[model samples]
Target: MKFISVTTADGLKIIINLTKKIWPVAYGKILTMAQLDYMIDKFYNETALLELIDKGHVFYLAQDDNNNYVGFVSYELNSEPNKTKIHKIYVLPETQGTGLGRQFFELVKEKAIENHQKAIFLNVNKYNNAIHFYTKLGFTKVKDEVIDIGNGYVMDDYVMEVDILQ
Candidate 1:
């Protein structure tokens, strides 16, 4: 698989398309349909994503050997002074167990080290099962948070972290 840096409108569009395919499956179980759709529109729109990039979010698209864009991840260096923040990450449901997810994390890990960050972190929904995938990657729950994302919804998540400088 190849990781492509997303730096243009075309690339952002690709990430938006992938989110439409991956979000429903990734969040369906723990989130109501209304909440799911709301969150998608709120965060995945081209305007919002571009704003994130302007604020230092770096996005990468993972393309398979056959040239399919199977997944994507975005991170921010120095989000916590000496740590990087994973803003988003998702792989197609069929690609879940094929090591693509770990590859995404490793992609972030390598960049974090190069940026002199000591660790990387992300927020995962508390009821989401991907917490297990994260646990297996050495991330420990650092804290829990309830973020009000408007529209009568709140994200109850665990702030998970893994050291990268070790």
Candidate 2:
């Protein structure tokens, strides 16, 4: 697999398209379809994604050997004073168990260390199965949060973190 830095109009479009494909499968059971559509429009729109970039988020798209996009991740360095925040990470459902997600995470780990960050953190839906995956990557739950993303949707999530070893 290959990773591409997402900074152009086309790159943002790929992220949007991938999110559309990944979200239903990833969140279908956990959230109502209305909530799912709302969240996607709220966060995955070009304007919202651009704002995240303006705020220092870095986005990466993972591509397979055949040059198809399989996943994407975005993180911000020093998001909390020596910590990196993983703002978004998602892979195509077909690629879920193929280590693509882990590779995306490892890339963040690498970048955080290079930036002298001590730890990386992300928010996962409390009921999302990915919590187990994060645990496998050495993250432990640090706190719980409920974020109101508007339109009567609230992201009830657990904040998880893993310290980077020097």
Candidate 3:
């Protein structure tokens, strides 16, 4: 597998396309259709993604040996020094158990450490099965949060963190 840093218009478009393919299947049971649509529009839109990139968010496209995009991860440094926040990580449903997620996460950790980040954190839906995956990857729940993202939807999540400095 390979991780490509997304920095161009084509790269952004690839991620957008990958998101459209990954989200519905990944979040289908975890979120209502309304919430899924709203979140997709709010986060995966071209403008939103470009804005995030402009703000220093780094996106990586994960591809297989055949060069097929299989997953993606996005993260950024936080206001607090030595901390990195994982903004997004998703793998296609078909690729879930093939270690793609773990590979992507390892890449994130490598990048974080390279940037001098001591810890990495992310928000996971309370009911999402990925919490178990994160736990297995050395992340522990730090706090619970309920974020109102408008449109009558709220993200009930657990903030998870892993101290990479260990």
- CA lDDT of each prediction against the hidden true structure: 0.93, 0.95, 0.89
Q: For model 2, what is the alpha-carbon lDDT of residue 89?
A: 92
Candidate 2 Cα outliers beyond 4 Å, as residue runs: none
Clashes of each: 0, 0, 0
Among the numbered candidates, top TM-score falls to 2
lDDT of 3 by residue, 5-101 (tens): 9977788888888888988887898999889989988988788889999999999999899889988899998635888998999898888899988
Better of 1 and 3 by TM-score: 1
Q: Rank the candidates by TM-score, best first.
A: 2, 1, 3
1-166 per-residue lDDT for model 2 (tens digits)? 9999998778999999999999999999999999999999988989989989998999999999999999999999999999999999999999899999899999999999999999999999999999999999999999999998887789999999999998
Provide the TM-score for each candidate, comma-separated.
0.97, 0.98, 0.95
User: Candidate 1 — which residues are off by over 4 angstroms?
Assistant: none
**Residue lDDT tens for model 1, 108-150:** 9988888789999999999988899999999999999999999
- Cα RMSD of all models vs. native, in order, equals 0.8, 0.6, 1.2
